[model samples]
Target chain A: MSAALPPFPKPQEALDAPELLQVGSGAEVDEPCLRADAARNRARLLDAAGRLAAEHGAAALTMEGVAAAASVGKGTVFRRFGDRTGLLAALLDHSERKFQAAILSGPPPLGPGAPPVERLRAFGCALLRRSIDELDLLLAGEPSAERRHTFPPRRFLRSHVALLLREAVPDADTELLSHTLMAYLDAALLHHLTEQCGLPPERVRAGWLDLVARVTRTDPPA
Target chain B: MSAALPPFPKPQEALDAPELLQVGSGAEVDEPCLRADAARNRARLLDAAGRLAAEHGAAALTMEGVAAAASVGKGTVFRRFGDRTGLLAALLDHSERKFQAAILSGPPPLGPGAPPVERLRAFGCALLRRSIDELDLLLAGEPSAERRHTFPPRRFLRSHVALLLREAVPDADTELLSHTLMAYLDAALLHHLTEQCGLPPERVRAGWLDLVARVTRTDPPA
Candidate 1:
């Protein structure tokens, strides 16, 4: 899962899995490995992206600057990510994966092995915390129509939440309820809290936990 | 009390009332004093909006076409509402007032004086029914932000819901839980169910009621 490929795969595979790596012990491997120069160029492109994101914000990143930083042709950068939108999505995916790992296995409360209700509360807080920390990354990963409509991460999060709620609350409508909870923590909600309401990220997380604890408990406080 | 004017002597006075609206004589004065021609134009605009929404979908409502259909200048349309975005918001507000009336005073289950749990279920169904019926209006009115934040209708609905939950499920964290319910009925979720999941709107409503009933009731079915 953590290997790099020598060349970009076919367009179909590229569309399906943006993160592709080629690794094997086959003599018939006609593709040359990533040259040291090519690897350096890739690293430079990524670094330039991070710097731009940090300084000017994600909305400021440009393909032209990325090409200049990587010392590559504009065509090369385009060929790699298709467009600025694609590059931004790929960058967002990196942070999203790390976030997924943290909730799935990294720590208590948010990770596995907590009381179901507490875990649900922790997951909401963790997600809210991440939204605050990676506002730039999230902004860059502009949710296109397709990503918002049909995506694995969105579905996975809902299913995970549904499972947790089913165990903790044991109501028949866990699936839809879980979906609602996921929507509550979605980009639109976060944007409203952070931008419109001018609420601090920590306060949002506190509200999330409060909601979660109340919803999941056997008998919520009056 | 049922007059068009506010309960207070003036609209500004109503702003300071304990409850949001006191439903007083001021409502009569606040009524739109549209000329016959202007009233005709307003109807045309709303009718065009509905037709365009029905045929081309919500994403298709543009300023130019709406203005042309209403036989008004683009500037007039902009003056009526600030922009295309504002026009959409106004359209939604129109529909929302009708919905608010229905839930607050129109009928059983949804109207006042029903069992709290039943009322809660009815409210969710009413909201879902309204969403499917007016999806374009809702989607168009969505504030252009990166995260989901509470809109006025959403907040009103949450407050109504919190009040009911406090009565029926008094032991639960009703305030946050109400938010969770509102989040589920968000435009995004409805689109997912109707467009992506291929579920009929009626089924979604039934599922919503079933889920709410299960959680609201104390004794579990064998």
Candidate 2:
């Protein structure tokens, strides 16, 4: 259906792209007030929160729970994060950096040691899994339509897909094809397919693999 | 960066779908109080508004202008549609129905006489043209996230595309592939590529044909 207004919410700042998600070491620059020990404490709390979210769900994570998990005062969590939104944002940034590092340098397939097609398959599957785990958290941070593509993390992921597609399908229009491929892995679309449409995560995963093959014009992996 | 949100605005009812767009008769059902001549007059006014919109972009549409163009009293325009929102919605529905009719029954390629691939190509080009014309109106009518895929008109178009895809690539999962194909023509994405990214409509149109070819694993048409 045609919308009366453009469907995307206009986003102001893009989500972090390449550099902003540089894992733990980079965040300290944004918080000059944190002395070394406090920074360590903050990292510890965040790590504990990550574990809590993984064990329960991102939706179940609470500042108090994180403190308890870290064996610190709830005040410590509050003093560090300010609010739930802040905590969740930081957690996402942490997770993004971790994920980025894993793909950028961690190992084969998702990293550098595999073929482009295999890498593309691994990337979508990995992204799908990460999205499913953090669906609620990711959904909340959605930007407006204008900024959706420019958002840093999304740009990074799409660029990665484009890179693989370039190698895999040298003759294809990988730029737009990248967007087509990334559209399948979009957080909102994935949420729609899995939660609203009642499609299973495995089915969604299979679909992504199928999509990669079609876009790359290759046979689907057996 | 990974979003804290899953990110789509969860829309409930899809923006008006197929039936909501029945040119004029269906709207009468919503207003049983109007007399025959009054209904005819109202439709006439809408027709004038549609002409005005096409001539001067939907963004330029105004009640005063619509009245002047329709050669009716400004009061009549206000009375008929109540507000700009109502009028635009009516206009969108009116336009949607006209478009639906053409594709469902009009002529070869776009209608039914040509092969499915040709029809598919015509369908995208025609949609791209319609979108370019009503970009603002359609965007304004964007549905909430939950209702987006389920939105009736979009579903109608996607089902149409899926039908073609099934014939074009019977082995593919046309259901998901249809979504993939539709994503290429998504209003938001089009707005981004054309307006934000500054890609011309022809470029986008080209991309769609290429995408269709790649998905069907066929060479681009001559």
What digit string (tens of lDDT, one per residue) describes model 2 on residues A1-222?
Answer: 111212222241122123434333233446567788988888898889888887887778898899889999999889878888888888887788778988889798888889999999889989999988888778777766656776777777877887788789876656678889988887778787788766667767777887887788787887
What are the per-model DockQ values?
0.17, 0.21
Please write out the lDDT profile of model 1 over residues B24-110, one tens digit for every residue: 113123237977776677667867776777678778888888888777788877766667766666567656667778877888888
For each of the candidates, the C-alpha root-mean-square deviation to the true structure, in angstroms, is 11.8, 7.6
Instruction: Tell me the interface RMSD of every candidate, in Å.
Output: 15.6, 10.5
Evaluate all candidate structures by whole-model CA lDDT and list the values in order.
0.62, 0.75
Pick out the ten consecutive residues of candidate 2 chain B with the lowest summed lDDT: B1-10
* Docking category of candidate 1: incorrect
lDDT of 1 by residue, A187-215 (tens): 66676556754655655565565455444
**Winning candidate number (DockQ):** 2
Which regions of candidate 1 deviate over 4 angstroms?
Answer: A1-57, A60-86, A102-122, A144-147, A163-171, A198-203, A210-222, B1-31, B36-41, B44-90, B114-118, B146-151, B162-175, B210-222
Candidate 2 Cα errors over 4 Å, as ranges: A1-34, A47-75, B1-36, B44-75
lDDT of 2 by residue, B98-167 (tens): 7888888998789878887778888999999998777777777776555677666777787788878877
